[model samples]
Target: MHLLKIHGSGDARLDDYQRPEAGPNDVIVKMKNCGICGSDLTYIKIGGIPTPGTITALGHEGSGEIMEVGSAVDGINVGDRVIVNPMQTPSNIGSGGPEGAFTEELLVREARLGMSILPIPAGIPYEIAAMCEPLAVAMHGVNRAELKAGDKAVVFGCGPIGLGMVLWLVDRGIDVVALDLAAERRERALALGAQAALDPTQIDLRAELAKLHGEVPSYGRVGVGTDAFIDAAGAPNILSEVVAIAKYHSRMVITAAHMKPIEFPAGRMLTSEMTITTAMGYPTEMPDVIAAMPRLQDKIASMISHRLPLSQVLDGLKIAATPESCKVMINIDEE
Candidate 1:
């Protein structure tokens, strides 16, 4: 088998790997599709994951067919299509594990149903099924926001995860205003059912939010009535800017991985009584995300802006690093 791995700074290459064997309690999946995430670029730029490891495999958002099932495993069989939950795996497969989905096959040790893997509905395409991982991350962010129907949200970023936030929010009947500097991303957000998509640089975001979500009056001051805000943009000033203008009692969820220390205006935030939280890997959101995939297939499909075969994953990573693309998928089964 062949897989992509990072050796050192700015060094990611395809190398031969031994084919995995399924133990009595393990399974081997034939990888079909995997999406290149922004973090993959970061890893390549700075060598492997920060953890103490000489080499690290790359790829997490993926889906595949059960090529080999464990003799002891139940409810999962060969030929069953499934999406992996990397976090549930013993070694966090892909990020810095012994196995990565960017390979011909992946070994799932101690595989179990609805935990290490979940069934992909028959109709969902493998490329879209590959998105389940990131969508689950987005769903975790949405769950953190504690949003309700008829509420309003402003998603700060129209990248894959941010766009996923838009889709999930819209499906829950929330009015969403997605912000991105890229016109293409903004347009994509609108296509995913956000009530409005605006470039924050091109508009008065607070004023626009006020008009779209109505205005909230609190302690002789007015703020946008949006009930929640999601920071998927990772901009240095996004947190401060949101804290400066967030409505009273509203919520903010930070899903973006900011590399640098950001300024958090505690004084400004205190006045609003707003709650701020952070979401990382999905805890219990993958099941719901998978269940929603069938109904949201069309919307999810629009998020994919580019596709490349596994052999061209390096180029795919370059494309994903640019603003022109969203959800660059590696068709592992191709070429």
Candidate 2:
């Protein structure tokens, strides 16, 4: 079998690897499609995600069919289609480590198979099912924010995750103000049902929020009061900027893992009594996300800009980094 291996910075190659036999309580899946996450590019260029220099096998967000099941495995058969959750341990298949879904086949432990190896809903396409991982992440962020009906929010990015945020928010009856630096992304956000999509670089963010939601008078200062401020963009100055326009007693969920230390003035947060929290990895949110796949199928489909086979994995990475693309998927099943 051929697998994608990341050796060093800006270095990746397809290497021949031996197939593995499922243990007594394991499941082996034939790879179908895996999306190239933003972090995947980061791992290829730099090194390490959870730990430094840990990228061995690449590609995590994927879906496949069960080609084999161990003797001890029950309730799962050889023909079951499954979506592999990469957040599991790397020692097993679909693990969110160096050993991921970039290969032709994967070995996953049955003990960790509950939410980790979700059976793809019948009739859902492999490419759509492959998106469950990222969509799950987006759903988890919304779950963390605890948004209420009719509440308004400003999403700080319009990438895949940010766009996913919009879809979830809109489906829940929340009005969203999608903010991004790129015009194309802003347009995409608007098309995704964002009440307003503004490029922060060109507009006054605070003033625009004021227009969407009425002004809030706090301690002789006036600003817009929004229900939540979700930052999906890992930009350097976004934290401080969001703090400036945040509503009093509002919730600010940091979905993006900012690589650098960002300065946040405690004075600003204290005055507003705002709750600033962060969300990591989706837990127990895959089911709801999968159910909504049919409703969001079209929008989710638009997020994918390019779909290439494993042989062109490196090229897919390059397109993902460009401004022209939103999401890139690698077809591992294509031989």
Candidate 3:
């Protein structure tokens, strides 16, 4: 079978791999559309992800059809459209596993399967179904924030995750502001329903928030500081900005992992009484993320700025890093 493998550090190409066995406990999918996650770019350029592993199949966010289902995998049948959740660790004693997410024909654990399956309601499309994973990721951040209706939310970063966060927050009737350095992203965020979008590099976030809410007549609402601040930006200092804009008792959720050690101000956190939580991608939130798809609309699929055949995988990765592109989708099933 043809699969996408990293040709070398900073590259990717089609490689013939042994076919996956259709075992009773296993499920096999014919690749369809897969998004090039930022993590995939890191692995290709940096040789691999933070963890060590020889380049194997690469691609995590994808939607496809069930060509065959193992006998043990009941309720699943051929022609059943599905999306594979690429992240998981097989349950076992002292099991420790973490690695890459890029692949064509994905084999996922039955228990770790996500909301990628069909039965997509009246308006949902297969491309959108492929997006449940990232939406679920943003949902994890929102879930951690403990957001409520009418609350204000600021999502930092206009990357796919950040945009998804904004869409989710807005769908819940919460007023939101999306912050990013890219003007295009800021525009996209607003289009996704953020009441306002600002380029933090050009606008003072503190001042902008105060302007929108007017004077906080009373300080004890506990809802101050945006009810919740989501740092979708991977930059470390951006996390501090999330903390800075948070009201007393408001929570700050870090959705992206930092590549460096960021200096955090101990004094402000202690004085403001703000709570902080970091969201790690896991199997826990996939269902709710998938269930919320109807509200996300086409904003999820619209994020796909470019689509290329799998033979051009490396070129696709490069496009994802550019400011002009949003989400780059790789047509892995294509020659």
Candidate 4:
């Protein structure tokens, strides 16, 4: 097997590696498409996630085809197209750890059967199927927000996850305002389905939010408030800003992976009765994401701005880190 293993900070190499033999109930899969998530970039730039020296192999947003099924593997077939739920891996290390799906071939044990491995419809492209993980994540965020139809949501970031939220919010008939610092991202957000994409720095966020309604309330509540506020940028001061802009009783969800403790303004939240919550990895989203695949394909595909073979993964990482890039897919089986 050939895998990209992280040795230390700023050190990852595609090297020949050994994979364990499949057990009676194990399945082996050949990697087809894998996405380089924001977390993957964070892991690379900051040594490792959680702590340095913890992660060995790094990549989890991946899709593949079963090449061989164990003798005891009954329900699964060798040719089935599948997505590996990295969360259910036996070691339970999460993505970007030693047991992730970054290799040419992966050995999946039965322990992960119904929980982690999901079979997608055959016609779905590997590139789109590779996005199942992130889409699921966005769905989880939406679920946490619990916004109703016709309510408005302000997504404070236009990265893959933020844009994904826009897709779902619009699909569900929730008006969406996508905010980002990048012009390209803002445009992409609008194209994907945001009612509007605004440069947060260019516009008065408070004023703009207030305008969403008729006008800023003259007393008590002063700004244009939103029903749901999502912070996906993980930028410094994002939490505080969202707290400030949040409307009374608005639901705010933090989907960004903040590396540090956030200092939220307790008074701001208390005054308006704003409910702030955090969402981690997706819990129940696969079915919905898969069901909406046809409608989401174009926008999801547009986010894949760059593709690279496993040999040039280092270069791919560089491209992925740039502001101009969106989702960067790595084709593992490219020869």
Candidate 5:
């Protein structure tokens, strides 16, 4: 088998490895697709997984077909199309773990029916099923916002995860206005059923949200009535901007990973009683995303902007790091 591994800083290579066999409670899967995440590039930039001189395989978001099932594993059979929950594995399958999904075949240790592996819901393609991980992350962020049906939301980015947030919100009948610096991303958000998409550089976001969602006045300050603000852009100014214009009791959820520390305007946020929270990985949202995939297939499928084979995964990483790409996937099995 071949796997993509990071040796040191800026050094990523596809190397040969021994094929893994299923253990008593394990399963071996023929990887079909793996999505390149922004963190993958970060892993390369910082020299390996955690330190300057370490080694680890390089993928997490993946979907595949079970090739060999352990005798002890029940209800999961060979040839089952499934998406992996990396976090549930004995060693988190990727992100510095002993195992990674960017390979010809993956060994899922102690595989459980719904915890370690989930069957891809029918009607969702492999490419889209590969997105279940990231979409789950996005859904976790949306869940943090605690949005209601009639509430309005403004997503501050339109990349893969951001667009996923838009799709999830729209599917639940929430009116959403997505903002991005790239026109193409804005268009993608619109195509995914966002009520409106705007380029933040060209318009006053506060005024624009007020127009779309209405305006509220409190403590002699006017704020947009948008109920939830999700910061998926990770821009330094986004936190302050949301604090400045958020309506009373509005919620702000930070889904993007920021490299540097951001200054929070605690004094300003107090005036509106605005709540700010952060979301990390998906905890219990993966199953929900998989369940929703069938109904939201078209919109979710549109999030993938590029696909490359496992042999060209290094090139795929470069494309994925650029703004021009939404979700760059490695078609490992050409399925």
Candidate 6:
């Protein structure tokens, strides 16, 4: 089978690998579409994710049809269209060390055993299904923030992950100010239903947030002030600002999954009585992540800004990294 293999740092190519035999709990799926993730950049630039041994395979975002199921598999059909829960594969090491979803086929457990959530339904397109994993990341960030209705959230970074975080919050009827330096992503966030898209470079969040919600009284928890602040850009020096922008009891959820050194202002952290929470990749979001598919059917498909065939995977990967496109997917059917 054809798959992406990283021979070394700054090296990745389409290579052939022996297909895995179906395990008792495993299911094999023919790939339809999979997304090029932001984190994949790290893998391509640096041979592997931080804290890792060496593995040949990579790619977790996948969606397609169930080709074959192990003898133990049941309650799923051979032709069911599906979206793979990226949580399917785990990082034996930390920070995406073992996450490799880009492939022509998928082997996963039938149940919640891993992050693989299947059966996306024929009505749903693989493009959107491929995003289930990231949306779940956004959802997890929202949950970690411990939100209540009418809460104000400032989502930093409007990339797919960041934009998805804003969408989930908006879907829950929360007020969100999406912060991003990219113009296209900001536009997509608004189109997908973010309350407001603010360019961090143009407008001052402190001024705007205060203007919108009265004086930035103190950040709140559950409700009041800026309840939740999620940073998806993984920028290095904004934790303190996030804390300062947030009300006193606010919770800051870091969802970038970025593996970089960041400065945390302990003095402010201690003074603000704030909470910092880190969301690892979909630790427990599989079931709901699957269930969320149909609910977000319309919004999901519309969220796609570009689609290309597998032959253009290289270009697609490049575009997905650029600010010009919100989400770029590859169709594996091209021969």
lDDT of residue 155 for candidate 6: 86
lDDT of each residue in 1-335, candidate 5, tens digit only: 78988888889898998866678999998999999988888888888866767888888999999999889999999899999999899878878777899998999999998998999987678889999999998999999999999899999999888999999999889999999988889999999999999989999888888889999997889899999999999999999999999999999999988989999889998779999999999999998998888888878778989989988898998898888789999999763
Off by over 4 Å in 1: none
Tens-digit lDDT track of model 2 for 250-277: 8889999787899988888766788899
Q: What is the lDDT of residue 293 in candidate 5?
A: 83
Ranking by lDDT: 5, 1, 2, 4, 6, 3
Worst 10 residues of 2 by lDDT: 89-98
Clashing pairs in 1: none
Clashes of each: 0, 0, 10, 2, 1, 13
In candidate 5, stretches whose alpha carbon ends up further than 4 angstroms from where it belongs are: none
The collision pairs in model 4 are: 209-224, 210-224
What TM-score quantifies how close candidate 2 is to the native fold? 0.94
In candidate 3, how many Å is residue 269 off? 2.0
Stretches of candidate 2 exceeding 4 Å from the true structure: 49-55, 89-98, 111-113
Tens digit of lDDT per residue, candidate 4, span 124-215? 89989999898889989988999989988889888889888998898899989999988888888888888889988898887777766433
Provide the global lDDT of candidate 2 against the true structure.
Answer: 0.81
Residue runs of model 6 more than 4 Å from their true location after superposition:
23-25, 49-55, 89-100, 109-117, 216-224
CA deviation > 4 Å runs, candidate 4: 93-97, 111-113, 213-219
Candidate with the larger TM-score of 3 and 4: 4
- Each model's lDDT comes to 0.89, 0.81, 0.69, 0.80, 0.90, 0.70
Q: Clash pairs of candidate 3?
A: 10-44, 58-102, 58-103, 59-101, 59-102, 59-103, 60-101, 224-247, 225-246, 225-247
| Local accuracy of candidate 1 as per-residue lDDT tens digits, 58-162 | 889989999898899999999999999899999788887778889989998899998998999989999989999899889999999998899999999999999
Error of 1 at 237 (Å): 0.5
Superior candidate under TM-score, 2 versus 5: 5
